[model samples]
Target chain A: MAPRNKYSVILPTYNERKNLPIIVWLLNDSFTKNGFEYEIIIVDDASPDNTAEIARQLQTAFPNRIILKQRSGKLGLGTAYVHGLQFATGNFVIIMDADFSHHPKFIPDMIRVQSTKDYDIVTGTRYSGKHGGVYGWDLKRKLVSKGANIFADTVLRPGVSDLTGSFRLYKKDVLEKVITKVQSKGYVFQMELMVLAKAMGYSVAEVPISFVDRVYGESKLGSSEIAEYATGVLSLWMRV
Target chain B: MTRAQQTVSIGLLFASTQLYLALFLQLIPLPSIISEEIIPVLPLWALVSFGSYLLAKLGYGVLTFNDVPEAHAELMKEIDLAREDLRTKGVEVD
Candidate 1:
């Protein structure tokens, strides 16, 4: 049997100063209720809003579980995780958002599904089940998201419903291999990871999850991100 | 895309229009109401195309270049300058 070790949560945050405490509390409650030993590694990209300072305060509160790895600047979303993964001690890693878009309650389910399937990775899918849906985004925002996923599906054919979704659980070794192969670091970074995983013959499964919009601060996604997505999509399309 | 990008694209379209006009202006010699009355905007289309091509190159350069190192170096220089100023004022920084 494979080793069942501590779970490390690598959360990449930027200007999520408001949601830090609540997200930490929610993770603590979820992990405590599930009786799992875990670590929350806050990977901040030197947010101007003092997100790293808040992470330090959270470290003082949780001591052992919460850790801070402040980056020099906003390099990219994908690189932030790569930076955090270097210091992650657990055999399994959970990567998610700090903006409350990814609820902590779904984590236990993701772990359970992975265990049943003996999967190397388990990602949350918003379009898989009846209950899973995005809340608090306008119709135009929803269309752009759906179109991106659809465009990816039509091209990459990664066999995953939600390639653009960031919330995922990965075996440390599997993540290590996948990250090494993923080159795109823009909006389609998540999509590239899954596509690369499939190319490498990794076992991946998805658990249904309901995604909620951010509760505080502004969303990082803008028109520029959409254009980046287009570039990333075409780049992958040509590669595959 | 910014205002410059839009202007370049419009200019490119105008360039193709001018090439068309330069070709059509010599043939048929249509009535004044059909061809001669229109604003003579097509001749500048070649310039528009050149401008658009340059703009496209600029856009590509912006996308492909990474400014992190330059930015980091700039920040370091500013920090050094500030440290010098502080030292002159007898301000200690740890």
Candidate 2:
């Protein structure tokens, strides 16, 4: 028989107190309905909202399935993943937002796509397929996102539709290898991870997903982030 | 080779080849249509066309970007369900 696979979802949160419980519940529902062995690794970076308290409550509710890793202060997102990965016991690792922007309903679809071709990484994209889209984003936001994607696609030619999307499933080994090579710390981290993964010749498959903007919190994409992303793309173009 | 290096090298090769072709056409007295009109502005035309294509693609993407209101509605319902279920299961969810 094929070896049983477990999915460890690493959710990095700063102040996701309100959304955490619902997202976790949805994740549990999705996993249980699909009958997949999974564990949730919540890496709370000292969310001042006392997000860890809610995580502890969740541990009581679910027991043994929720792994909470609390950090001292607000480190960068890249380090948050690195911290969470150390606790992940599953062979497959999924990284996504705790703000409900990346719904857990699509996890099964990603898994199905991965199984079909054994893709090294499966990413949820909002740029491909008829069903893929975003909710609650204004025209300016849409333009910026589309323009950024086009700019990166033109320069890097990474062959991936969504370069900045964070919702992704990776073979545990592939993720560990790729994460080590990634150097960016902020918003560019997501883009760098995908580009470097492609450079490393890992096969990637895309799944169209509806990315609803964060329900409970503000989504940040400022001018500095955009400038960093532009430079990051150019640097990756030259390096990779 | 890196993508930047490959692009620059290929671009230089193409530009030099075009220049050589232009010089050869002038020396050989080829057809004016092939040598003067087309050869002189070939790169310009290509650049403009590529730019236009990119612009059109971006515009199309923006216009057709999916909204998915149903997803948000469904999620609200799911949040309610999740809260109820968690509360019943002895998890205090705010």
Candidate 3:
């Protein structure tokens, strides 16, 4: 018997108080509108701001649809997903940015793609076809992101259109398998997931998505992160 | 400019600036030991860096290229069909 499809959205947030309410609302609206049985697992890594407080209030408004998993401190992105996955009751899992960079409107597209075939993963790409693009970015920022993609693409050859995109849907089992194989946290974690999925022969689907820059808070891509991403790709190349 | 173009130009600009500085220092005739030791090493450093970059690129390309062509093809087909289905339903995939 085929199991019913249920979606678990894991949103790893830190200092996202202002963005949390809107993101949650959007997620709830999109999922309910599409008639998808879904639960949003928000893992807040002890944000110094009122992010968790906002999430708790959202939980009241939505009840069973919103699950808050608060940690003690600012954990890394990779671990946050892992932590959120523990409470996920769905057969499929979603990992996305809570900063409004990844809109909930694209969730339906991801679901539609996954439904046509039993793809192990459906990734949102900002570099595929006419439908994909990045908006609200300066030239330097855009160049850096593009260069990183090319560098990773040229080296890792992940084959997917967007290796660094956080917006993606994965069959729960497939995500569990790939997540264990990836050693990176933070920015490199997304890139490694695609590389590992392909290496493991899991089918990956891409949906064109418009990636908008964050409207709130400071951008997290600092010099240290770029350095980390480069070294991480090199290490993955050497090992994987 | 596209990100790819900007990246390439920036790389070229950095390389040219380094070359100009090296040539300028040579023209000013610094102490022979400092200039000579550094000059020989500069080219070697550039060569090593470029070589490593190429090797990493080629190595990754060779290692991961077409490793799962069949899987990729199947996945792409699924994505295309799904996109068409959604477009018919009036969902903006972009």
Candidate 4:
């Protein structure tokens, strides 16, 4: 068997005190179960809820496995990953939400796909195979997600099934290259990353993943974010 | 596009086809059931097909177009275990 590649998960959290512990535990469990070497870097942007404190406790429990990288204020999502990248020691970097929505169980499959195919990136999609789709979302939310994906696909034709999905694995160097090229922040960051990747001719693969609603905190999505996402999509269409 | 979305889109296309067919038959002055029963049934067919389309998007098991897979339940269990592990470590959880 080929030696396992070290996987570093850069989880960005903001006011996720209650969710921090469980997600870390699940990450630990999933990595151990798959017999893969992994590290989780918790990048908290000074959440007032003291999510950093809980992350600190998790670091103590997990010892060297969990690393906490703290920022002074709430920065954008794109920057959080970039900050976490400085601390990632693994050859592969996994970017996911601190919320429970993106399950860690699919991490092994992503790693396996990357190893076998030598793809530059592998994204977890909710629109792929039998095991894919969203749960705990109402019709409105579903429509919004589907609509955003369709609008982007019609304009950019990125060719990937799920353009807005955040759960993805990237080779360290490839991520570093593409991250620098992406200019969007907030909700559009994930979409822009994939668009840039496709435009740059990077090999991308999709793994079916089931997305669940957050079990703890309130969702950050709102009307303003949706409006911004639409504008962002249009802007990206013109530029890319 | 998802299977559920495709199902709904295709359903709408079928409804439109029926509507156009009925209109065309009416222009040709067909004396068959096409002018009476089939034309009236066109709207009813559209309504029923659209209703079924919504049901499919909602993951109604009868249609089985986009039902949430069983793997979710298992993943939820794993999450629960992770929570339990955290609680055992003396973290206060509700």
Please write out the lDDT profile of model 2 over residues B5-42, one tens digit for every residue: 88999999999887767665697577877787776787
The sequence of per-residue lDDT tens digits that candidate 3 reaches over residues B1-94 is: 3479779999999998787686657865678886777765776799899879866754553333222233334334544554464445343332
Query: How would you encode candidate 1's per-residue C-alpha lDDT over B50-72 as one tens digit per residue?
Result: 66865564454333322223333
Report the lDDT of model 2 for residue B84: 98
CAPRI docking class of candidate 2: medium
Off by over 4 Å in 3: B1-94
* Candidate 4 or 1, higher lDDT: 4
Instruction: List chain B TM-scores, each candidate.
Output: 0.32, 0.69, 0.37, 0.36
Model 4, residue A17: C-alpha shift (Å): 1.1
Q: Which stretches of candidate 2 lie over 4 Å from their true place?
A: B1-25
True contacts kept of each: 0.00, 0.79, 0.00, 0.28
Against the reference, the lDDT scores of all candidates come to 0.76, 0.91, 0.79, 0.83
Clashing pairs in 2: none
- What is candidate 1's lDDT per residue for A27-138, written digit by digit as tens? 8868989988899988888899888876776666666998889889987788988999999999899989887777787899988998897799999987756546666666
Model 4 chain B weakest lDDT span, ten residues long = B58-67
Model 4, CA-based lDDT: 0.83
The best-first sequence of candidates by TM-score reads 2, 4, 3, 1
lDDT of model 1 at residue B11?
100
Residue-level lDDT for A224 in candidate 1: 89
lDDT of candidate 3 at residue B43, scale 0 to 100: 66
Compose the digit string of candidate 2's lDDT tens values, residues A87-194. Answer: 999999999988899999999999999999899999999987776899999999999999999999999888998999999999999999999988888878999999
Clashing pairs in 1: B15-B45
